[model samples]
Target: MTEQEELVICVPGQRLCVADKSNVAGAGTYEQQGYIYSKLAGIVKLVTDDKTRTVEVHSITEQSIVPAPGDIVTAMVTVVNQRFCKCSIKCVGDIVLTRPYRGILRKEDVRAIDKDKLEMYKCYRPGDIILARVMPMTEIHSYQLSTAENELGVVIAHSDEEIRQMMHGFGDSSEPLFESAKIIEDVVLQQMKIIVRRACEIADRRANSKKSNIINGEDLLFLLRKDKIRLQRIVKYLELKELGCSVQKLMTANDVPQNVTDPEQLDIKKKVPFQSFLEQIDNTGELLENSSSVDDVKRRRCIRADIASKSMDEVHYMKFSKARRVSFANKNRHKFSDWICADGDVTVSKQAYTILSYLAYETVAQIVDLAFLVRQDQGKMHGDAIDRQRLNYINPFTFKPRYHSKNFVMKPLTPSEITEALRRYWSPQLDMTGPFNRWSMRRPHLKLLSC
Candidate 1:
């Protein structure tokens, strides 16, 4: 093999050459499907012999090393107890390990001077980086660790208060500390994963119960309903997203005037500028033009009309009555009218009165139309002679009874029966001939007996 061929680098699973009797697979190389592939990421080497050529890959990276007895190691305390503390070994001597190894530090080995009095919590807390010596392995899983020497102790320690201070920006200003950020991020990600996994499992179960292979939104909604807080958060997020998207679309499509100089001046309760209002009208026109369907255009128009009607109603109320204006101004307070003198009489202009009357008429008309529809439905049900007793028991609005009892059957009274019952209960002749009336009457009947 030439020097140029020796310089060829190959990654894991990369094909090197065709495998044959003349070319045999060597270390770090495997032969499959008549091809020799590299199992390590390194430079490809070809060794030539008398009969065959050997293909191999020499790795460029260092091999993983583990802590041995008597080796000095640096580790972070993970769990602390009164008897012992558990740590994760990060480095051996000067070299950092690719992955951490488990180590146990007993309280007796915390310090040589006060071995008996040493407490694991005082010597090493969780998140503290410490130096220790690896002892002979007592267990196959974790290595025994000792910090008996003066030098072998906590190198860096951060208390809970210090972490809180750092999070709240009260710590050192020169450098930003984010030691706990990664841990927090990992915990949050794990929680999210658990929630999503559970939701997916529920959805899968629901789909299976319904004899379906596809899970729909209803299944997910059922899962979300079980966690109301999370569902509320999701709903709030969706609403904000929708609002942001609408704002973004408006900003992108039109050159809206920036009247307010500061963000603080942009209040929802503040009156809109004339220019902004006109610009909104123009933007709405543009939106209508860009709408994909007639339904979209009609929906937008209806929303606009609703907003206009609400504003107009507010204007009419404020103009027609000073009491309403005061109430509107002091909306946050209960009994706002008590703080100010109410008008003895409201003097409504003809135009305001006309608008209010029309609004009332429209509202009543809508109510009447709804009632007529309900009555028609009831008539059709009655005409069909299907469940007539149940129909009488049902309410018009909800189409369900106010109360239901299995023990008692309800029978609705007819108008004539109700009138007859009232007449019998309050007959004029019965009331006039009562003992109370006889006691209050004049004694003219007694005079006839004397005559």
Candidate 2:
């Protein structure tokens, strides 16, 4: 049978493969002298690229989110110096992120055309909202930011009330014909009133449809959002309405199930299976007896003799002289190194290679990778395509792959296709340090592979 009959749990320092040049290491693994080893406790996976004929490990886990190079970020300037300015990243791409990512914008990166002549003060001040692209990570604490492009720069500036008053002064004039700015503001106000009125009407209609007498703040907010109101403004308006109430109190009350809060009142005991629990309790004594059998004089002697004979027979294979008699402490400390038999009837040596192969394959498959693939089918391209209205997900009403670019021309590969693509595209370049970054940096190829 081929490898990967079952999942294998790998631990740090476990050998994955005898490093040949063909075997390239992926994440959660490192290569040593002619051998590939794991660096994290995870599953092992090995992928073969058709073009490159290379193998690499893949690691999967929930990793801390951080801003990476080339990502467009929205940040607020916190500090400024002659050479560099410091800012806190508030958003990455379209996500409003938290847990502060510090960024630095150098004077040279402030503008594209001017380098030496650029002044930091003229470009930015503390509290200025700047849009920047992440530069190569230079240090651990802060990310390097560049506003060198036309679209990347101070999107909002911290202006004093005096400037605000001056800007709004045109609307104060009692003159029959005000300035162009006042006329534009009046038109915008009229449009905004109409939109808000429409949104309220929609909310009322929805409440009526639900047979509800009153529309809550949530209903109003949802209707407003559907009408294309800014999320931040909508949230602020909701906050203003609920100013006297404790939002946290309401959230907590909703989170805890009613049955859990008053189990007796809910008659939860009747719903629970008492027979299974009683059976478990009855078996606990038998389990304790079996565990204590290790302390039995006869069993202890038998185990010692068996271990002694095995160790003597395999003396030459022992890496350390002291391993001839392995201590219980050593075994306990190195429990992660203990192997489970893939084929229970056979000795470890006969099935060791098979087990290792499975671990490698699993490791490669688990680590998720992002890839752009061309849409192979033309079924979804038509204007009246039924697929367009089909819900991508059951819970969230957003389109499938929620984090895609707006008007994104490229289609992301499906999960099923990714496995084969990884196998087909497994190349030595993927073994390079920062392989994922390398993949992203390169121009995405349009040559699609079929499953």
Candidate 3:
């Protein structure tokens, strides 16, 4: 081919011009069986002189490069062990490679002196960038590397903990500070941008799933909840925000008169009247009754007496105890007499009857809450009642008749059967197993029991 001729593109192993005295194989080409064949998928070129011609194949793009013997390469250590360190060659000589090639550095090839005493971990670590000379290809698709020379070893080394500390502005002061204030600021800004981008992506995905465009605070809260430590702070902040209070005010506010009109200004240490405490309880009950959101239900359930005391006062504590006693007396007034004269032989005290009634109410309330949660998890609306199967699952106390049995009787479980059921369902945790075992032993003769 002449310089004026049309360009001929040839792939590897494709036959080109015949090999003769006037034509010879050049770079990217090989002479085989009296024919010049292309060794690379590129354009075939011909170089002519007065005596002979050299046929070659040149790539359509930049010249193809690979790490060859004695060529220096930059590699990032992927793994390091006692025997060898594995890395991926990122650059050949001064040229950055488009794709990484596998390289291995044995412990013996790490340094020239004391090769036998050299430890791979001491010389290099994972994520370390190192310079090494390519020895030769020993295995398929992998290059043998060596850093025995004085100037070829770990060029950059930073442990994960070091990187984390640097990111948090707590890096070691002993080391030379190469990073400037601007660089630190830029890194922080870039990190914030990434976090914001990730949060937006999550919110957008959730909104898309709901077939909506508006992302709400709940989505951001969901993201925060993924980090358990941050979740607690976020929850506290939200609770304080909802109550129209701040942490500083809550900490510094003094005990004031109960006559304070604004709830936010009310002193947590001030004594709350019995009537006011009762009113708060009634309001809480009303809120629970009218709650439509599952989150509202959860929030209400998390309200503890101690947490409420933080906003109210110690006077409410005594009032709360008295109110509970009064409520229990009113609820079991009629049943107290029946419980005392039960079967004309057994007698039950008012306190015992009240305790039983309180336990029964608590269990029923918990079952109701669990049923609502199960229905919500099933993608049901607030108005939707729990299905029969789910209701049975939530309230295991419900009698499920064994219709398939020969004696299909509708009866309550015996004491032994109840104990067995409790043992089977309850996990072997201290709180659960200790109480259960003690209760079972104390009431081994009881006819019926409900968890």
Candidate 4:
């Protein structure tokens, strides 16, 4: 992704000039949109005329790979000026990013927070590592990049390359950020699968529609959210509604369930207790929808480690027989060994705790139990844990919940229980204006609720 790493891709619709490392031009440099590929890695720079169609590539490496949509590029913040911070892309593949192509990161695209009072020093120093998404390629070969994304900022801080690798995705994830980062990969892969799967599923869903009520755009968006891969399945379905209810019914050859809440009540608002909250005229839903969808936020949670971590004093769970687990976790973790980093494997990031304590330490059974409780809450269960009517999900691995218990077998959370965490190396108060997607949606809801 770096400029020196090799010019892999050109602008989406436009191709730029390229050359090889030996100062030889693989493809001659050409001019387009008032800017020409002035400099190319490896080969000598070729100054072409305005009328030229193809670009002269210098020192072409591997036929000059080009940048396209959805390429993960890593870069370092070289300049942190007042209005913007500049950096050169690095690493396209295992080749080790070389050529330093300049990319500008406007102050707005830095993070998700207020901009005027943001301190660049706290968010990003001159040498801070940044992993950003390529939002757009602007004029003059400038890449319009964004760091406001979760898991898009620095990952593996500290100078140790090996530790960086572990933080990135190498060793057993022992830190919250590291583990979240690991999960991010899983989620991304899942998203890719979803995108592909949905296509075919929609087709089949459409084919089976008894009423021939075709799915619409809105339904496509919803399908994209639930499981992107499902949309690409055998059902070449289409929908006008984002909920995709129409498409689901068509594909399955069944009646699309109405938005009614209760089986018999018919009115969802009456059945749901949060009716008043949903009925508010604060216009929060629109804001949230425009910024970030609820589903998008959850997906990003798995993808990016830049989540909030409600931290407290490191209180140990003494009741549980975790002495051996704690000792083992501390001894093997790399962050624990580094005096600059781990203090007995306890890192500063809240995400570190989530990684070490829950995801890493707790067995999969415990995780399943936790996931069940969370989902139950999402399912709108009410009352104390002891009085819950029913459990939402059964652990596939466990095969059963605690017998004779109204709720799943679980203990009350102590104050030290870390609810959420964000694994990152940047200061708070990033560019708040950038697209939060699902997380962003909550802001409007939060604002309305706060009032």
Candidate 5:
């Protein structure tokens, strides 16, 4: 009721909506009246135009674009295929069992205890109602739907074929049904809670770290911190060793090149406490002359350039690792998507993969025959598996089947590794400076996620 809330008041004279955009061509429609909605609860986020009036609407929390692993959904059974029963989702993103959606209840994931006893017909007849959960969204953008709860069954249905047929196309079907699907909504909701609660428990058990287990900015930060520290140590240690050796070569050289011995360029004249040695040698010239020999200044070859060039491999290694962290985070959150309840044959998720771990999957996998053999020959590559191993082949956010079981995973890495990897990853590309947390992760890698 705040004054700042923009609302469309019904004009006293107009029967239908009329706005600037409406007169241009055709902006509004009677079929989509829910376009105008209250500020508090409304499913419709987009408004066609300024002329549309806003009204108080209701929304049942359920499955949405970014569903967690255990969020339950309500759906109406649509197609009964050989291995699965497709349904139309009435609820999305959250755990709303009142409004269902279209989903495919796969034959295998039909029940909680004994899946073999699940006869598709007994479980659900066409046009029957159902309750399911967001198990996993496939890369192809289909909801890997499941009705694995004791009470997650048909909630509402209309036995009369003609009435149900009319209802399908009707804008609103609040009328009482032959088999009141509304009555079963609460029951489905009850069972959905139990099932979802249990599913969360299972996810928690599978989680390795509280931070790593849940996909967010905090986990990214943790991983980056660890990686950065280790990388810094490696870089600093290498540089220190290289510098130390250069000074050592300068101190004990008989005929090193003048250019190579340039103190300004070579950094070989670092202040050393060698005055005592010089004084001792000068005072005891006879003893020093006897001790110092031609062999002492025989000009040993310098290995500074060789060592520095060899360390460049660290950059390649780190780049792949950086992408892998993004990939890993993407893989970990792969199960969480808005695409879960979408059509498989067509569009999947509305978004793209937010991680880059799977970027060079095929190319890298090709080089490593052992990896290729394991995935191609044995054929056990899956997104979940890649997430467990932190591989990069497919972007995990969108539902594209091609990236699902990307067959490459660079190993010896875990969720903690992504943090340090981001410094090298995000640092090189964009000047984004923030904790490598969930928010930071959600922040696209500018060039990587732009467009």
Candidate 6:
């Protein structure tokens, strides 16, 4: 063996050194066939305890925390009655229980001060998960559970699943669960912790309910989010459990938040509408017309355009015609360019119109509500006329487009009229130094007629 290999760390089942008359196996190591093998995957150390040297492997994995008497555990109520309630221990302290231990919370042991006045059915119901203290073993079948303390009681219930789901549905991220499951797990876990904490706060506000003095779900979530190593190990343990594999794991420190000593602060922002855009537009389009320079006008127009885009919805009207194109040699067949030409009267090409006409002719149902279609001819055209349709009205409840009674779009202003208006109202504001400064002499806003 090389000199570096002799001192390197090792994993489980790796042979370290010979365990003979002088050498012996220590903790985290096992000896067989005159050779010592590491029992744990960790760093190997040679310790001279009382002058007797032995090799040992110390694992880096955190040790598992087990439930014991006097420890606080979070349990879910499975069966509840007037006499007692049965629960499955979900966690011991801050560590989640991989294997849930059964526990029984007797009615008499629910509260210390109000034992006589309190009713088990009134206080806790089935499916209500609680935080309780473990009592000394009194029953052979289950661990004795106590919630007599102020902080120990039902923190969550089955009825609250909808609220939990609502929180999980936030950010519209539920669809990506299959794509990135770990991310969903982390997000859901964080959301669940927040919901549980809120519920606890609400419960603590009750007149009869005592102030919670125990660690909450938020604390557990904080530990899981901040400790990547621990989270990975936990996930590994869960994965092993599913695969029926054996795993030896530990929790290094008691994973609890340092700020758990104080109650969490709550902040809620009120939803309000942005009415500044509407307020600016109320001046009869003065903001656009009164601009001192082209830059100012451009800036205002861009701002207005952005606001308009946000309020307006884009609608794609699908062409449903299905007329097949006839051969070019046929005199009855229209030319290819004619089929795709655009006009103020017909937005779609003759080819697209043929299909829409076919669909309209064949189907009894209206194709307007169906899938939206785009014309290949218009695809290359920047700022196509069809894309600039401004709706006359939008249904407030449904946000659906509403057309004018006559089903006609508003006509554009004549180029001469536009030029005259600009010269009278806008030309004086400009510096007018360049040859293109004259608005009347520039490109006319004339509509192009299709061939």
Q: Considering every candidate listed, which one attains the maximal TM-score?
A: 3
Score every model by TM-score.
0.26, 0.27, 0.32, 0.25, 0.22, 0.25
**lDDT (Cα, tens digit) per residue for candidate 5, span 414-438:** 2122223323333433334435443
Over the stretch 1-451, how does candidate 4's per-residue lDDT look in tens digits?
1234333534223434333332222342433444444333434333334543233554445434333334556777777777888877775333344455567778888888887777764576555667877665765676767878777887545332222232322111222232333343232223323322343345346567433233233323333233323322211211122124434444486544554333343222212211233234224343112232344322432332211111111331221212212321234444433322222322133322222222222122222223334544444555355322222222232222232323222222211221211111011222254344345434222111000
Backbone clash pairs in model 5 (N, Cα, C under 3 Å; residues 3+ apart or in different chains), count: 43
CA lDDT, every model vs. true structure: 0.48, 0.43, 0.50, 0.38, 0.36, 0.43
Best-to-worst order by lDDT is 3, 1, 6, 2, 4, 5
- What are the RMSDs of all candidates, in order? 31.3, 36.2, 25.1, 22.7, 25.7, 30.8
| Tens-digit lDDT string for candidate 1 (1-451) | 4435649877766888889899898976777678887756788888889999898888788634467667799999998889999999999888788788999998877877867777665667677889999887798899899988878889876434322222222111112123332232232223323433344455557656543333233333344443333333333433443445455665676654375333343332322222232244343344213234333322432342233233234443233233211211123122212211223332223222222222222222222222222343544544333422122212233322122332111122223332332233233333445456553334222111000
| Winner by TM-score between candidate 3 and candidate 1 | 3
Poorest stretch of ten by lDDT in candidate 1 = 442-451
Which segments of candidate 5 are over 4 A away from where they belong? 1-67, 93-102, 158-451
Candidate 3 residue 26 Cα shift, in angstroms, is 9.2
| Predicted candidate 3 versus true structure: per-residue lDDT over 1-451, tens digit per residue | 5567668987756888789999877877766668877756788777888988888888887655466667799999998889998999998777787678899998888888888887776678676899999885689778899998988988876433222222111111112122322232233233323333344555567666543333334433344333333333334433443344433454466755445545555544322222232244343344213334344323433342223233323553444444333322344445433322233432334433333333233332333233223433343333324343222232222212233323222222123332233333332332334455645433222211121
**How far in Å is the alpha carbon of 265 misplaced in model 6?**
41
The predicted structure with the larger lDDT, 2 or 4, is 2
lDDT (Cα, 0-100) at 149 in candidate 4: 74
lDDT of 4: 0.38
Best-to-worst ranking by TM-score? 3, 2, 1, 6, 4, 5
Clashing pairs in 1: none
Kindly indicate the candidate among 2 and 3 with the higher TM-score. 3
How well does candidate 4 match the true structure in TM-score terms?
0.25
